[model samples]
Target: MLVLGIVLFALGLMFSIAWHELGHFLAARRFGVRVPEFMVGFGPTIFSRQRGETSFGIKAVPLGGYIRMIGMIPPAPGQRIGRSRRSGPFQGLIDDVRADSVKDFRPGDEDRQFWTRKPWQRIVVMFAGPFMNLILAAVLFLIVLVGFGIPTAQPVVQSVSKCVVPASQATTTTDCPPGAPPTPAAQAGFQAGDRIVSFDGRSYDSWEDMQLAIRASSGTVPVVVERPEPNGAARTLTLYPQLIETQLLDLDAARTSGEPRYVSGSFLGLSPIQPVTRQTPEQVAGYVGEMAQRAVTSILALPSKVPALFGAVFLGEQRDVNGPVSVVGVSVLGGEVLASNNAVASEIATMLQLLAAVNVSLFLLNLLPILPLDGGHILPALWEGAKKRIARLRGRPDPGPVDMAKLMPIAYGFAIVIMLYGGLVILADIVNPIKLNL
Candidate 1:
């Protein structure tokens, strides 16, 4: 059953990718751009056909799909224009789309080529996939919002992360959240949703401090808290401390930076407060973005953030080399997420949003002022634009295109690095397949 669920989820994700590409195809065709071929895989065509002006087909691999717009990839000096591929709908149009960017490009035409379109239009074409993704995400969120509205939980502060709390609380905070800090011998006296402000005689700004104070209690001691009652009224509750184990980090391992180590012992009973349901898109986006940004920033800042980077050279953190997740990871996550949704619309919407985010990021990243990337190409264009005026003043011919070839090495290097990292991730997955935990 679990395996079936995983398969179902994977299929759903593939559909989403197909839909994202379709968005671009549909738009390009609508704009009269010539679309040559639209395919659902990367390698050579296993099944194909030319229908009307477009050729369509499915490939042996189901992992990815693409719509080949004539002139999408810059035609080398002499390639033909307005070409397309269209096959069949035997398995149904798993992927179909709006427009062909080549519609504007005719044989021996440059000014009307995609490259000739206003930069804004070019950007739009490049960005549309991701744009659709964001929209899809919003729609999914809407469904989730209207269906099973997120519920709110008691605002009791019981758990704190090891990074958030003082070393002393390390022993107890686990129970404060989902993990058990301690049971019978030191069961949590507080409830799951209890709001603990000041425990024992110590005033703590964090659960860490609170935990330390409690562990330090060592015996029955009175604790006070401001908690919300079942009727929505606020009240005070007092509890006594029970004996519990504590958490402590090893100085040597902690110094490694690469290997953060912590030791925790049982604590008096303590479970975390309940988590509330998400209520708004703003709330979801804010929280999600915050988490994503922080995670990204933390990884990037790890070297500076860790004092013993020099000593930790041999020890590496969770091989986050892929800078978090590779495409495989995203697809896996998406598969798991979209699989359970009975509603195809909601699933598609969610999947589209994910796709949008990916494409938008791709487009933006490509536009960065660097060589070999579209950004690199654009940078030269910018410089050439300015240089044209200077050349006109100096009565010199305009230096067109500014030799983009120079960036080839840089682009190749970047591509290799990405490929290597991706290979490593793929290897890891093959050696130890990741389970869909959802």
Candidate 2:
């Protein structure tokens, strides 16, 4: 069942990627840019259909898509060296020639050239794919919030959760139910009914925030909180977060339809200070945005020496880095979260929410300044524009287009790194996949 869901969810995510690619495809077509092929997935084609000028196809591997824009980069491998041949045993003798052909070529017609377009136009065309993902995220969030209402459980004190206690009070306490509280987590002092408001500085909304902060802490954390007294008074507090073990529950299914079990974890044993419900679109967005911003700001503050974060790692001390995720990861997350304790309806909503989050993460990561990424390309374009402006001021000719010879090496190197990282992550995920216990 888990594998099935992953497969189906992956297909959905692929279509989402297809939608993103479609955004660029349609825009390019509209702008009269020649699009030779629009493919879903990479490697080899398994299915294809030609529509007007574009050949839309699905490759056997469900990875990512590519737009074969004329003159988008350089020429075909055979064309680069001016060789005329397709792959075959007979062509094996000319493998070197074919390889060099990728470098050759008659600089084709300018009409279909991507570089020929205005910078803004080119920027829009390039950004369209990621833009689609962002839009999809926003729309998904809006739908989840407006149509189904956000699935937020109250932070009310519950007997099932780990104990929440203030650091100062624990010294005088005599309760030792279950095994002694995790010292690391207890020393920092997290108590039930204390009301967790923020994580490492991010507003705490759902368990995701708490778990991320805890794991990021490498088992220790600096916590900020508001304690609501039974007498209607609120006192702000702080604590040292301790390392705690966690057992994840399948969140999606637990939303309702499946048996709900608790996932154990390192906890300050705290709940929201204030018990409030946000069921409206505006309320959900405003609150989720604020919480997400807090997480983002905390990450931004890493260099500023604020409470730093170090999440758990599977192997050694090193953290994992990889090329951007393909759809496979999202499905796995969706499946794992399904193990959570929740009603059926809530489970569905959580699944959607998780998917939105994955989309947002993917959307944002692509914007990092690296070659083959839109932002990376835009960086140089912006620099060239500045240079051109400066040259015009000095009454000199515009600086020539950037030297591809230099850029290609760096870009290809980065691409290789991405490929390698992606392979490793896939391998790690397979060996010890991230799983939740519901």
Predicted structure with the largest lDDT when compared to the true one = 2
Each candidate: what lDDT?
A: 0.49, 0.57
Q: Candidate 1, residues 1-438: lDDT per residue as tens digits?
A: 334534655565556566666767776665656667788776777988998877888887665677765544343223243332534432121111112334434565454344444444554555565455445544545555444343343325554232223344445333354553334313333454456555555556545555555556645555555545565443444444434334442332243345444444324455444332446666656534543444434444433433222222334433332233445655665665566544664455445444434543443444556543445545655665678688889999855434333345565677676556555555544433344333
Q: For model 1, what is the error of residue 164's alpha carbon versus the real structure, in angstroms, after optimal superposition? A: 16
Model 1 reaches what TM-score against the true structure?
Answer: 0.57
Report the lDDT tens digits of candidate 2 across residue range 244-310. 4443434323323334434334455544333223367667567456535533443343233211112
Q: How does each model score on TM-score?
A: 0.57, 0.63
Worst 10 residues of 2 by lDDT: 304-313
